[model samples]
Target: MAGRLYLVPAWLSEDAPVESVLPTTVLERIRTLNDFVVEDAKSARRFLTACGHPGPMRDVAMKELNEHTAARDVPDLLEAVRAGRDVGLLSEAGVPAVADPGSLLVAAAHAEGIAVVPLSGPSSIVLALMASGLEGQRFRFLGYLPADASERTKAILELEKRSARERETQVFIETPYRNDALFASLLESCRPGTRIAIAVDLTGPEESVRMQAVEAWRRKPATIGKRPATFLLLA
Candidate 1:
């Protein structure tokens, strides 16, 4: 029988209690898997330890896969699964394969006809959307914006336009350090009447979620600082 590919979720906040976000069943499933394809092995080990995994870290088989991982090499990460040994795919944080690189491995598993199982847990995107007070019925997650200033501004404007026309919510994230820059871009590029939502440090002690008009946001600017955040807009 072919083994399964368990898409395990990790903690969003390093300091949050494991049980708070991860259910007992998910933890138990995590403990059963000895082979894993992880975005970061060190963090994966730490997460396992925090989950009360009984086995020694050294005994676990880990394969690293991240932005640096080549596409051609992704299939190799599923070797253990092909050999009838269950493998887990873990992200550095949140659920695996949503906006994560683990999607490559998951796609490989599917191509090979392997069973892929997803365990329930915290997903910052989902959590943020639930709290954003935006239109949950029609929303699109754009992941990240372009890196260049002009391109990013263009992307923001285009997304805002889409939000306005479709009455759909546009969701995207930014690097923690660039949170302020993205916030500034949104204010500059969006119309004054556009509804904007900011969800910061989700599941962390500093968690904050707020939604308001672009004009109101400008009147009293939010100190996004260096915190990780998700941005949503509806015009």
Candidate 2:
């Protein structure tokens, strides 16, 4: 039997009543997934507990699919199929493999002839672009930025150049703690008129997407810093 792989969206807290899920419909669909593979084990368990679906959470049937294991253990996930289990790949929040730690497993599953299933749901990249008031038709999600400050700045310079030449929406993210630093770097590095969007705590009550000039951003107080967030840049 072909192993079934489900890509479930983690947009809101399981205990969250309603308002937290931007569009009510997104949460409606999430209720159906019976099993999940989380990027953070502790968080995943907390989510399950909030959803009123806590189970034995057997170790044999579950795993953490985060950066710690995505590269080295992706192939091992296929054994789940051999074991006759329909598995789900989840993340700490939002969509999996979209800057999350599920891409390796996705590639492995396809290579091994495992069925890939994606559930329609929220994507911070798309949501940020949509709300940014920027051109959404042509966009590229750059995922996360480099760890080193100088390297990250260099990457930003290159990407800004790419955006100018190609008329593309360049999107990327940074570690929660470095949000302020990245934001500052972008403001200082990019051109004054460069249009940028930052989506923070998307889909939750704290959700916000800021779109404005790089210079303009520096004038205003920083809106996000070291929080779960994503960013989008448009030329």
Candidate 3:
């Protein structure tokens, strides 16, 4: 039989202890694997080390799959699994596949009849939604917004309109360095009644989750600096 493909999750914060976010069962599952497809080899090595893998670092086989990886090459990452050796798919942080390039490999695994198993772990997106206290029953995750100022403003307005019309929560993320710009655009473009929630440094020591109307936010504008954050909006 072809080997199973395990979707592994990594810690959200580099400084957080492994047991804090990952359960003992997840760590035990990781210890049994020797082959992995990762977004970043360096971070993947660190994550595996934290999990206390049984073998030496050099003995663990790893293949990289990131934004720069070609579409044609994604399928090749599964060659070890095809040969009956279990493989793990890991993201730079959080769970694999969602908002990650590892989705390409997961799709390929499905096409080849490999059994894909998702191990339990912290997901910043889900954690943010849980804390936002918004319309979790009906929501959508829109990945990322446009970087251009004008385009971003237009996108923010469109998201607000869609949220109002559908009564759904809109979720998205921003690059750490550009988080402030995105926050500014939201304050400027969204209607005063629209609700916005900003979740920063989730699962880390500096974690913060705040939600209020656009009008309230403007009254007390906050800076996200360079921390990783998630944005949620409702109207």
Candidate 4:
């Protein structure tokens, strides 16, 4: 039988300790996996160390899987699992394959009939949605919005309309550095009464999740700076 493919989740914030966000059981299973496909090998190594991996760091096997990884090269990363050696798939943060590049590897594992198991851990997206006070029954995660200002504004407007028409909540994320610009576009493009939720620094000491009308937000504008944040809109 082919070895299993484990989808391991990382902590929401780099500043957080592994024990705080991940259960002991998951960390123990992680230590047993020798091969890994990760968004950043260096970061994965650091995470493993923090989780109390017993082996020497140099002995662990890891392969890079990020935006720079080519589609044609994805299949090669799963060879170890196909050969009956369990492999772990880890992301830079949060869950693997959820808005992360590891999804390609997961797809390849499924295509090859490998058993993929997802371990429980902190997810900034799900954490944000659960705390946003928005309609959780029906919602959509739009991933990262367009980089261009005009296109982003257009997307904000379209998602807002969808929220109102379907009574669904819209969730999205931004590069920490571009969070300010995205917040501005949301305030400017969304209707005044449309509800907006901002969840920032999730699973960190300074975590904040607030919900308010766009009009109210205009009165007391917030500067998100470079903190990671998730935005939810319900119209």
Candidate 5:
């Protein structure tokens, strides 16, 4: 039988899931997951060390498969599958491949008749929406706003219009540094009553989910884009 492809989920806390493995039944699962495919091998190793189990650096294999990863490297992931390696792909934070890397590996795995399993836990997008105070029943996740300020503003206005017309929550993320500009654009584009949610450092000690009417946020002085964040706009 082909080896298992375990997609493990790390916690939002600095202490990774490996620490949770000691609490009881989680230990069994930890033993089963001996191999890993992480987006940031260095970070994973650091987290594991922080968990009080400093393992070898190579314990988690990473072939630079990221947003900037070349399409050619997609095949290495397949080669690993044929070797019957049970690799666990993880994102730097939150869920893997949800606006993170791992899709190439997944697609490659599928093409090679290997299994792809998704281990769920904290997803910033879902968490943000749940606390967004928006119409969660119907929502759309727009991965990222354009880098160009002009186009970014256009996307904000268009997303707001979508929420107004369809009553759907439109979600997107921005580079942490660009978050303030994105909020500025949102203030100028979205309707006054349109709802906006900015979830920051989710699941971390500094986690905060702010919900406000677009108009009020303007007066309150926006507080997004300074830290790692996920943005949601609701009609």
Candidate 6:
């Protein structure tokens, strides 16, 4: 019989306790696997250590699959699974394959006739939307916006327009260090009546989720320093 591919979620914050973000059953499932395809081997090691893997760190086999990984090389990462050895796919944070490079591996797994199992865990995107109090039923996740200032501003306006027309919520993220810039662009480009939600450090002690009209935000602006954050908008 072919082995199964488990999609494991990692903690949003290193400080978050494993028991708080992951179910006991998920942890037990993770402990049973020794081979994994990870975004970063070092971070994967740290996460497995936190999960209390029984074997030594050296014994766990991890294959790297990140932005730098070539598409053609993705198939090779599944060699262990093809050989009847179960493997885990882990993201740097949150659930694997959503807004993550691990999606490529998941696609490959499906094409190769492997059973893919998703383990329950925290996801920043979903958590942010749940707290945003926006239109959860009809929403779209727009991955990272353009790094260029003008392009990002234009994209923001377009998304806001779409949200209003379709009554859908628009969710997106930004590079941690450039969060402040994106926040500024939103305030400047979006109409005063439009609502914006900013969720930062989700699942961590410093967690914050705030939603208000653009005008209100301008009056009481926030600084989303260098931390992971999710942005949402509703027109």
TM-score for each model: 0.97, 0.83, 0.98, 0.97, 0.87, 0.98
Candidate number with the higher lDDT (3 or 5): 3
Instruction: Flag the better candidate by TM-score, 1 or 6.
Output: 6
User: For model 3, which pairs clash?
Assistant: none
Tell me the tens digit of each residue's lDDT in model 6 across 41-66. Answer: 99999999999988698999999999
Off by over 4 Å in 5: 13-32, 50-54
Write one digit per residue (lDDT tens) for candidate 3, span 99-194. Answer: 988999999999999999999999999999999999999899999999999999999989899999999999999999999999999999888999
lDDT of each: 0.92, 0.73, 0.94, 0.93, 0.73, 0.95
Query: What's the lDDT of the predicted structure labeled candidate 5?
Result: 0.73
Report clashes for each candidate as comma-separated counts.
0, 2, 0, 0, 2, 0
Say which prediction, candidate 1 or candidate 6, comes out ahead on lDDT: 6
lDDT of 2 by residue, 59-102 (tens): 32457777677376678866766566677787787678887768
Kindly report which residue stretches of model 2 are placed more than 4 angstroms away from their true locations once superposed.
12-36, 58-60, 70-72, 221-223
Q: For residues 1-235, what per-residue lDDT tens digits would candidate 5 score against the true structure?
A: 5665656565565733444323333234434454666777777766545444434555645555677788777767655556777776767776676677677777777777788776656677888889878888999998989999899878888888878899898989888898988888888888899888899877766788989997899898766646778889887
Best by lDDT: 6
Residue 17, model 3: Cα distance from true site in angstroms: 0.8
lDDT of 2: 0.73
Clash pairs of candidate 1? none
Q: Tell me, what's the RMSD of every candidate?
A: 1.0, 3.1, 0.8, 1.0, 2.8, 0.7
| Candidate 3 whole-model C-alpha lDDT, 0 to 1 | 0.94
TM-score of 3: 0.98
Candidate 1 on 21-63: residue-level lDDT in tens? Answer: 9999999999998999999999999999999988799999999
